[model samples]
Target chain A: MQKDFLELIRRASCELPADVIRVIKQGRNAEANGSPSRSALDDVIENCDLASRTSRPICQDTGTNIWYVYHPRSVSQMALTRDILAATRKATRLAYLRPNAVDSITGKNSGDNTGPGAPVIHFHEWSRKSLVADLLLKGGGSENVSAQYSLPNGAIGAGRDLEGIRRCVVDAVFNAQGKGCGPGIIGVGVGGDRATSMIEAKEQLFRLVNDKNPDPVLAKLEKTLHAQCNELGIGPMGFGGLTTVMGVKIGARHRLPASFFVSIAYLCWAARRASVSIVGGVATYSQISQQALKYKLPAVAARKGR
Target chain B: MIRIELPVSEKDVRKLKVGDEISLHGTIVTARDAAHKLMVEEWPKFVEPLLKNGAIYHCGPVMKKTGKSWKAVAAGPTTSIREEPYEAAVMDHYKVRFIIGKGGMGPKTLKACKDVGAVYLHAIGGAAPLLADTVVRTKAVHLLDELGVPEAFWEFEVDGFKGIVTMDSHGKSLHSALLRKSKKKRDAIIGI
Candidate 1:
């Protein structure tokens, strides 16, 4: 189980799924030939190719480890955490991940990429017998541009409704310019307190890029925001071209009457993510954005695999 | 388009204009948050020789040890704005001619570049593998034990390393110009 999980990290670091590659190709084709934006996208495509081929990290930062795990009630969180930390340490040694976690005040790296609150794991109990774990490697550059807004932002004149939400989202993309490494993906959380809102925002990124929001209203907003953001001409790496955002995924939760928060988590084009399913000591690996049907389950003996 | 070689000459840096595409050759040094802070405070004596009239890239590269040497697996430009506070002082101290990074710098770094005849080059962020291909060799690394992999100062011999002159020695800044233009457009769209 540990070895399979480590392989998932290695794969996520190196290979961007087919869906992300598809959108990037679409953005590249939309650009005019010989334009700087086109050239920038060309480099991005080349980078993806090389990273995947060489089984190297797609970006240097390699980012914070975020794991979303849905497991049967029988599974132990303590065991999972232990295995995750071990896998992370092994990954760091293999150069599949950078040594990212640091002491906030002392400016010390944990070296093994394990420390207090590193490899953040969100575990959910499920009725099913199997366990599913999804990993998102959110790099630092795009993470830096993520923003949260309080309602009635006087600067942008954003009121506390969907219309205001649209304005705020557009403004966030605009302000990001070439910084969050656009053409980027935006995950938005419409409600909740500050921390929950940000978590929900990041959680939305787990959705496939091409997937529609399950809720119709949010779906419409997502579609509208995607179009409007691309209109900003931020293009790839903010070189100014046709595409700024590759996709926008919005998720919502109930908020307190006093608070209305909109949090945005911007993901770069690398968009590295993968998932694994463990059932009865057999493990099957898959990528999130790639069409699930396309992957044939490669089962490994969970105990002996490690 | 321009071709630049490091340690870049003041005359060559002066010739670079805002918005010019450039391909760099020779050697460049990589530094991010930790290395920058250390460089400013300690002003490492060894770095002065390497940085003088040369470029400092804002990068934390993904490196692998291959046999006796290290190799840059992925080396992309990090966001440069974070180093804005120390950049001007470092530029002055080292006589560094080019600052290579992404996301541009602020008024302080721009002023420093103009004053010191340096330029801020914008490489495509997230194109680490593409950039790594240009690195012919990992020349050396400093502060590795203290700073760790991403924060360490890595020197590399590069060929055909491409970037854009976003902030030039002449005081023009393409990043600033783009920000202004984009803000106007954004305001119009949002009715701000």
Candidate 2:
């Protein structure tokens, strides 16, 4: 039962997601002048089409294997984390993924995307029947832009509101402008301590790129924030383009003020990951891709800079 | 718009303003993070010769080996900002005059672009498959074992490879201008 799920992730790691695939295709409107945009879109799509055929990553940055586990039953006795790691090992091998984790100081490659910080698996306990895992293979190009603000020490603004949060998201993307390869989306973590905030920021990516915030206030804030981010003109690949924020996924954690840690994790569209679920010991998957996970991007393509 | 080969000099690059587009015909080498680091470390031995006649493209293509032949299905320009730190040194070491990739180069690369008669060409990001069509031939390769295809040196014989002049030898950058312009419009609408 577990082997099939593990095998699914192995295939997912190398495969581009549908949403990301859409963004990769839509980001190419820059060449609207002629076939450059269309041509580039065709090229990327060809790569995507061949991704499964070639069993190769659509983009080079295969990223870290992150598992967001939502447990169904409060009384569930499954070895939650152990099971995830077991599956991670299998996926890593099948994907032929390059080792992206190792000693930050020694700078040695782990050779298989595994290490102490290799696959960051997070679990949330809930009551239900099946276990659901939102897998994300976060690439380094986007991950390198992660920013942390230890509220009491680093934050410059007082009375944290939508503006303050917006600024943080802006500043993060701005500082990352042309570097983290914007116009990428910034995952904003509002309401939590430093540790909790970091995790929340990452989980926010699971939200659909185009879905609107259910909360009216939050939705307005998100729209405003996204528009400002695009204004940064850190175009396609940060060279300057219309679509910057595919969508901003926000996550919150309840914590005291003193425990507050505001963190922002930026995600480039190349973010890749996928997963399947084990139901009644039978397996089913959403078949969502880590790449081509086009958030709310109006344009559904990302073109290569000619 | 007619695509013509333009040989721009450093002095000419200094005069470029924002939003001017141009197409170039010449030799360019593909390299990303790892290869850039390697070239910086090795300096003369690895970079000098080809750089004299070429440009450096920041790209990593999705490749595959089928029946003893290597083919690129999607070869797109990666983020160029990651190479900012090493670009100036590499450009100076190799005396390069052009850079082609997605995302514009950084201040250091920008400065080098101005000083060395170079231009940072912006390729449409995420169009790897389309760009692959432009690469008529992969004439040779280097350092494949160490870094693999996406990060290896793929000397291509290309015809009419297209890109926008986001950052030119004339010190004009479309990215910065767009950011500044859009930021104001957004601020007004948001009233922030």
Candidate 3:
């Protein structure tokens, strides 16, 4: 199981999921042939291919190692956590992950990627026989640009309603610009406390980029915000082109009347994440976008005579 | 694709303007939050020679130890904004010619680019593996024991390392321009 966990980290670190690759290619195609946006996406596609082929990390940052684990009653949470930490340390030693955990108070690195709260894990007991773990490597660059807004704020003229939610998200994207690494996938959370709002927002990122929300209202908001963000002309890397974002995912939770918090998680084009499930000693990894791995942009392929 | 060698002349960098795509070939140094802070706070003299007319990349790379030396696995630009407070001072003190990073710097850094004859080259953030391939060799390392691998000053010889001139010596910034344009659009959408 630990070996399977290590492989999960490797795959998540080195490979861009297929859907992310597809949207990036779409973003590139939307730009002019010689535009900077197109060229940036070209570099991204090339980087994806190189990282996966070499089994190197997709980005040097490697990001916060977040884990969402689900297991049956047969498994022990303590043992699972111990194994995960051991695997994280091993991954860092292998260069699959950079040593990211820092001691905030002491201003010292843990040397390994583990500290008091590092490699944050949330475990849930499930009725299923299989044990599942999903990992997300949320890069610091994108995390820096993520925003949260409290409603009834006069700054953006937002109130505690859906209209206010739209305003908050749009404002966050605008402020992020290219700094969040444009052509971003936005995950929005509405109607929770500040902390839970953020978690809910980040959780939305675990969904496939093209997946629609079960709630029609939230889905509609997602579609609307998606188009609105791209219309800002931020483009890829904020170079000014047709595409600014590849997807917008929104999730909502019931909140107290006194507080309406909206949190935005801006995931970069890298979007490093993967999942694995083990049942009866047999482990299965989620399928990465193999089609994306082999894809070469037409213009680039033509120039290189591939 | 404008190509410039590292240790570039101010005259060559002056010719670069906003929106110009560039490829740098030569020695470049990696420095992020901790390094930048140290550069400004302590005014490290050792880095002056390397940074003078040379480039500083805002990066924290995944590196593997190969015997006594190190090899970069994934080296990509990090967000440059966090270094905003310390950048201008470092650029002025070191006479650094190029700052390769993502996102953009603040107004002081923009002003310092003109005053110090530097330009902010915006590398594609998250495009690490491809960028790492450009590294010819890891030349040397400093402050490794103090700052750890990610925040240490890693010197590398690179060929065809690429970025866009988002901020130039002429007092222009592609980032600010995009921000202004995007702000208006955001206001319109939010009805603010």
Candidate 4:
């Protein structure tokens, strides 16, 4: 309750990580100067950096976050919801993110980054003392293409196999092409109720690119998914280039085997947002907004090709 | 660099080829998703006065305030294919002869361009700050209060609005041709 939601929002909005900044700049420079001025591999890194520092959003579409609060109890859920939104608006404004919300039916702009029933916050409680709120700052480009299919056991026979997920992700991103501001990251949520699987798919984003899933099988899926997504050749900004997905992440849960949903949530390179002060009564939490990341952007030109 | 005029004849548009960059001047209509939907379905009667073989820029500008006036900052072209469903109708209905946007439109729009003597130009994406420089002045801005500046029609006095020819009246598209050529390179990299 003590966490200042407004301050948290401001922090989340205005700032982003140096690495993210570095990559977005990389993308912008790649575009401005690509061989029409450039090369594919170099452009990918450049766009990621340009998106970060040009202070222009990595892509103009700085997406909506589908926040999931896996709370230990109901006591803090109210503040939990309030805190994240406050943080979302603040971080969005500061990041120089574009205002992207609009009424789907009426075509009226929401004016702020928010509107009615927006930033859908789903809460679940347990006896544990801590609160962990995971946010997926879902961008419109990729989100437009998020696919969920309730495959018959035969369709995805192994509960979840690498090929199906690969096809799903690659096809998903490929379909997005220039729409999702490509060179996106796709998260696959497997083995849950339809909605939960979708929710968990987004959670994988909090884990960062190239991070391994504790489950070794899921880890393999991530690697394979990452490789295949690139194979689509959607490329950076869909200019017949390479390095489409920086990585693919999967979040899995063991659910009743009778029913399963392969929920895939897509995130563009500009995966923006911050989490500060996940609380449990007297216990406190700090934050992980990209801007708060205390590392310098690595020069990966030499490493990019290899 | 090619220079094209409005209401170009099919023979003239067909003379242009993909990869030939051009600077276009003269009257062009501006529209995106909202304006596109209206024009395709049934645009307002007032809109009739606006269309004259004009260019449709797939943009929604982020504006800034200048000393005494307001100016667009980042006005780069957005992906134009999103308007594919309504593109042909808008082209034929309003006689929109040119489409300037990033990425390219699909087959139907390409066909319409060829039949209607139009061309789809591919401007560089993410070059908004630079692209914003070509816009010299805007005349008779409409719908600023209704659909916001972005969805509104901003007729401009542009000089050297640079764009690459993606699709021409002969039904050619650089975006597709680039993909086919690159796919072989991508496939060759496979195998040990």
Best by lDDT: 3
Q: What is the lDDT of residue B154 in candidate 2?
A: 75
Candidate 3: Cα lDDT at A303: 46
| Candidate 1 deviant stretches above 4 angstroms | A289-306
DockQ score for model 4, please? 0.24
Candidate 2 lDDT by residue in tens digits, B124-167: 56545556666766766788766655667877656566676778
Q: List, residue by residue over A158-269, the lDDT tens digit for candidate 3.
A: 9988999999988888888888887899999888889999998988887777666667888899999999998999998888888888889888888998999999999999
**DockQ (Cα-based) per candidate?**
0.73, 0.24, 0.82, 0.24
Worst 10 residues of 3 chain B by lDDT: B36-45
Clashes of each: 2, 54, 1, 42
Stretches > 4 Å off in candidate 2 = A1-7, A10-56, A70-99, A123-129, A150-158, A181-183, A231-235, A239-241, A271-273, A287-306, B1-28, B60-74, B129-162, B182-192
Chain A only TM-scores, each candidate in turn? 0.93, 0.80, 0.93, 0.69
How well does each candidate superpose onto the true structure, as a TM-score?
A: 0.94, 0.75, 0.95, 0.73
| Candidate 1 local lDDT, B1-192, one digit each (tens) | 688778878987898888789999998999889888888889889999889999899999888897889998889999999999899999999999989999889999999999999999889898888898899999999888889888998999999999988888888987787778778878777887
Tell me the deviation in Å of residue A174 in model 1: 1.8
- For each candidate, C-alpha RMSD in Å? 4.3, 6.3, 5.1, 6.4
Each candidate: what lDDT? 0.86, 0.63, 0.88, 0.60
Which TM-score value belongs to model 2?
Answer: 0.75
Candidate 2 lDDT at B187 equals 50
Please give the ranking of all candidate structures by TM-score, highest first, separated by commas: 3, 1, 2, 4
Full-model lDDT, candidate 3:
0.88
In candidate 4 the C-alpha lDDT for residue A194 amounts to 84
